[model samples]
Target: MTPLTLQTPEEHPFAQFVRILGKGKRGARALTREEAREAMGMLLDGRVEDTQLGAFLMLLRHKEESPEELAGFTEALRERLRAPALAVDIDWPSYAGKKRHLPWFLLAAKCLAASGLKVFMHGGGAHTAGRLYTEQLLGPLGIPLCRDWAQAEHALANGGLAFMPLGDWAPALQRMIDLRNTLGLRSPIHSLARILNPLGARLGLQSIFHPGYQAVHREASQLLGDTAIVIKGDGGEIEANPDSPCHLYGTAAGLNWDEEWPALAAQRHVKPATLEPEQLLEVWRGEAEDSYGEKAVLATLALALRGLGRAREAAFAEAAALWQGRDRAAL
Candidate 1:
């Protein structure tokens, strides 16, 4: 005689996260900070199954991620980053490529770097079509694209600026971003990447094209004890549109606030029919004049200056001076 025993299969480690999000309308709820950290840890470590990954990402996209979720996810990412300590002044995340205008913010960052501020800028590859990404223009703009942290450190120490592709430091996130076409929609990773601040910079500059995410970023930065500025920037990038009033949502020193910046132009300027990357150089080299582009650069620079504790008027003044004093032959 033998005793019959039955074995039960264990649940997948990642299944719990998916179930939490897709538990039907009433049963579904957001993951708490600890749960979010664990789930994101699995995702970053490639421990999540493909099916689970797809479902989790889509669910977050559908429900939209909460500030707590974003903060938790950022905590997971920061823990996994393979970067050495660097004295970076600004953490500028450039995920959204420009559609309507050249990235005037690129010029702003370069101007700041030339003024001796260490800027760490990172962005994903061109996952979407018809958009000019920052990486694409780095060559023409004479900015160094660091392929590794050593190169990044070198660039920062030598030139005061470094633009690293997302894949270089955070390959898992880059893979998730690459799923845009497969998923047919953006996932929460797009939002999370903006606030990674892997270098632990004093100030972070973020931009979102979609409405309502500004508050998410502001609150998440507050939770992470990060100083950040979020804006509905031009073409979803962090370049302010000089032709329209811009709203800024930010968090610093345990406080959250908002401000409205009036349009620099009295009237709206028509967008260029085509985007020429060389125009960035032209504007920088003092070889050509673009009224719209120049103002956009100044406005974006002012936003960064403001984040660094300058008064509104003082920020704009400092931005103008930085732009004016930039080496014409630098680019």
Candidate 2:
């Protein structure tokens, strides 16, 4: 293992990734499959420092990581952590957490649970957007944060919910998260974190703000040969929308897997009313009109379970019912 103190840019695996990202359309040789994997390896071993980490992050954010790079980085990061025992686990890679009202990814989690799905929601402890994040949302739902690797793994196995706080699990990479504020620029780490899957679950859900991600996610699933469900989640988190049909992507074997999801749901898209924290919480807590709050969550969890293109709406409904039951049990 390269000691964090001895690591330098040239020796770091992230070096090539920094190059591809830094050149900003000028870098020679867009990283090939193997090279992309090597760069991801650097991330896992802690060879990248704050400045280089920041630089590569920004460069990729500017250029947007290639689908190949995204998959490679995901492979490297997931390999470092303990793979989950189950093939089915809801691991949503949510990039946008601090939304204006409340981030509803946790509600997504509850919906999936109601459908009898297990979820692993991960995020940074704090971000500059000045709104509470997943950590705060989970607190109201009785999910406790895990501080160590063993505890996190145990949570995934024994409990349906676990929080992989980036600050606690990967501090070096976490340091780069703060650079977003100092430079006021987004970076590759932002995308990478949302793609990071500790459990290495074959089926997972991810969301992104950049529309470019639709293509990238499709490519990533194919390159890695992992069956994953991808969504342009509402505001970059893995929550469904009542306003529109969020297109889905399937990926496996370094190629986009068969995307059997409908251009539209089996049914028509209904208008989800604009919601606030109070109106949404009961739905989030599974206590109110659940069409949006409940359905959104279930969709994510069901996608995690049903593989590429199985029973989309029904799986979503199942997830909602599972979490709704959990919510009632607490009462």
Candidate 3:
């Protein structure tokens, strides 16, 4: 007979949680991070129902999630999509796309790689659900959506870039993502998936939805003690908050969310610039191929400038100037 993989919600949860809530009537058992990951696996695998899943998810969120809980959530994400090691020397993944107008993620990847920096970009595939996703946007740059770990590693090592589609790499998490409609709010899985460090790479890039998540994500990353660019997405992007030039630095220390942000770094917002998907797509394509000329010049130019404060903005032109040299072009 085959050994059974038990469902997490059906099993034990809240060992760390027990201190506040006290021991349960349901026998002395506790779930580890891996166990929590496994339980999430079950939920994503369709082994659990709507009510049961909601209870488990909300319980953790309402009760105040522990580091262990967060770790378990990431573990499940890793289990579903195993981390791929890269020969390249960068720790992190950048989500693609910009809200109003900037494929700054692509610009960042290209110039950083040219300047001898490595970057891993994950999730370039179309959203199975309604949310606007990044995978499809990088197509303009000929950056293919990596379908598996093998492809991802190869791409990062050779191209200094990688794309991990959620649907393909982490199906269990995908299942949890599907529940967003029924639950009517983001769950632990959504938050966990966003903050995931599958490569153990410290310094990856992230675009977040809520300012409130700053502390939770900051604490988690600080525990890992690796620096990462945690930015509020301009268009749900993992790029900088173009409107505000402040970058949130989170490691295994604490939240830097309170730092004073700057506004002078970004160019004037071309407000009401683009809501048309067609126009947006056209701009993205133009930026990738350098077709928009001066209007879209700074998008890629900002890639080479990565210092703190307004000083970084001044050097943008000089950085963009480097990519024009004949010998510097990347294949």
Clash numbers, per candidate? 0, 19, 11
- Between the candidate structures 1 and 3, which one is better when assessed by lDDT? 1
Question: Which residue pairs collide, candidate 1?
Answer: none
Superposed model 1: Cα runs more than 4 Å off: 1-7
Candidate with best lDDT: 1
Per-residue lDDT tens digits for candidate 3, residues 1-331, read 9999987564334323333223354542445556666676676567665666666766655555555666666656556655556544343344333445545445455655555555656653443354345565557555656778788777777766666767676666666656666777656665666667667653545556566565666666655554545556565555554455545544433434343346444456555454333443343334334233223334323422432222344546555564454132232
Q: All candidates' lDDT scores? A: 0.93, 0.62, 0.53
lDDT of 2: 0.62
Better of 1 and 2 by TM-score: 1
Candidate 1 yields a Cα-based lDDT of: 0.93
| Angstrom error at residue 120, model 1 | 0.4
User: Model 1, 104-217: lDDT tens per residue?
Assistant: 899999999999999999999898999999989888787899999999999999999999999999999999999999999998899899999999999999998899989988
TM-score of each: 0.97, 0.77, 0.67
Model 3, position 170, has a per-residue lDDT of 69
Tell me how far candidate 2 lies from the true structure as C-alpha RMSD in angstroms: 6.6
